[model samples]
Target: MTDTALVVGGTRFIGRHTVSDLLANGYDVGMLNRGNHENPFADDGRVTHIEGDRTDERDLRAAKLSTEPDVVIDCVAYHPRDVETAVDVFGDVDGYVYVSSGSSYAEEAIPKREGETPLRPCTPEQATDESGETYGNRKAEGDRVAFAAAEAGVNAMAVRPCVVYGPHDYTERLDYWIDRVLTHDRVVVPGDGQNLWHRAYVEDVASALRTVAERGEPGAAYNVGDRRALTLAETVETVAEAAGTECEAVPASADALAAGGLDPDDFPLYREYPHLLDTCALAALGWESTPVDEAMARTVADHRESDRDGNEWDPGRDAEERVLGVKETL
Candidate 1:
């Protein structure tokens, strides 16, 4: 009945939510990690904690031996070799789901789809380089590895999430926007602020992992994202509403930002073109995203309760004010 689930790297972000999702769905959950982060479910009798590194195949094998999990959700397979090793160790499990990224898609399209969209190709050197430049290539290679494992009779599948945001988001991308809305009257958004970047709420992503583990076809890849996407302007509005505040979304062009010694890339979650993923495949599995407003509410509430101001993504309000001045003059 697929009653047992083991999450690899379940101490942070998406993985942490995945553990909760599995627990809520009546599966006995086990989390295997390097012990770098505290286990949020340590006291829960339904959860078991295994101290290990995902990079080590020995640790994976040991965890499997101890847990005998029916399904495994891997959230930290960053390299092709990592996926290869995991599939080899967990080949006999009922299901093995790998967390991939939208960056794996090689081409840009309005809505990138599974199977139709080509994935970034990785050379052996890029597969192990561990640099940001090769992240997509490496993830694409990992997706390929999972496909090959599925071909070899392993119930392995891949789920690609574009950008994930919610509670416990360490990336601080969306946090940047939430912080801006809470702390400022004028939020400087790059470009026209209609730039669309598909984002999945963390809980929806968690449910996707569980749903894929239960219902996904072997060797198939599915895209995970919000059913209803929002433009950057709409995103800011959503954040404002969530914070129960009013703010002006000041759209700053690249030239305006450059006038203030800032590049468009300095702003987090800014994309030149609309980045959307076709999530129909995931929806067919009977999964749905949390409503945008509801999702933002939980996210903002968590932000208010936490100390993450996301200042790391902020280029200082003074620089933004300079950009605003340039915009006003133009």
Candidate 2:
């Protein structure tokens, strides 16, 4: 059981949390990445960090030989070219937990229920060579290649989280709205305030990834999202309440937000999907969501406490004090 768990691109927001969870849960963790950001586990000597590029074949091959992990939890993979690189490097590994996305679901055309349809089924070389337009498409294509390789040989499982939010999130997606509602008392939305959004805490997502690495059945796909699908307005209100303050949240037009450089990136808040996810399957595996109210409060607290010298989130500065992205002003 001490065999190492290789985390590819494990320096990102979700990757950090998952690495922590893996370490805490008794796995010998090893991170493989380009050494871009500050090392999240700088203090911990229990795990090894292999600085390399997953997209690069030589780098990945060297990492595979060095770590020789039992499980490979991919945290960054976009193109099939990346998948090709990974499989070429690690010909045989225990479990391959691909960090795929729930966006693989074709929610625009069909309501995505678990097993409702095979997720991003294998496509021909010409047909699947390109992707990554939307969150769903990129994730779907990535998952397609990963699952196909797993089918060939390798214990592979995928988890599609609705919207992952926690400390140090890349893209600063959730913090934007949460900070706006809690601090600025202004919530922006497009078209209708009623358009819904779904989100999951980073810790919960991390734990789910760990669980899959530990006990996930091979080639299985699990949706790790909360059932609490709240509309944008309601989510704002809930965030405000969790912030322990009564504030005004004025919904600005989409044009205003876009002009203000508030264009939604990773988690588009105003996307219209009645049901973002049915995460019952993840829960069935004994993976639970940190309560809505609790997670919300923690997010708010972390945001507030993250204020360092009143300049909490300037990317130009170098510091591990905020080893994550902060879009406090939204």
Candidate 2 lDDT, 221-247, residue by residue in tens: 788765566677777777788877765
TM-score of 2: 0.80
The clash count of every prediction, one per candidate, is 0, 2
Give the best candidate by TM-score.
1
Q: Name model 1 segments beyond 4 Å from true.
A: none
State the weakest 10-residue window (summed lDDT) of model 2: 315-324
lDDT of 1 by residue, 221-283 (tens): 999998889999999999999889998898888888998898888888988888999999999
Q: State every prediction's TM-score relative to the real structure.
A: 0.98, 0.80
Q: Give the lDDT of residue 31 in candidate 1.
A: 91
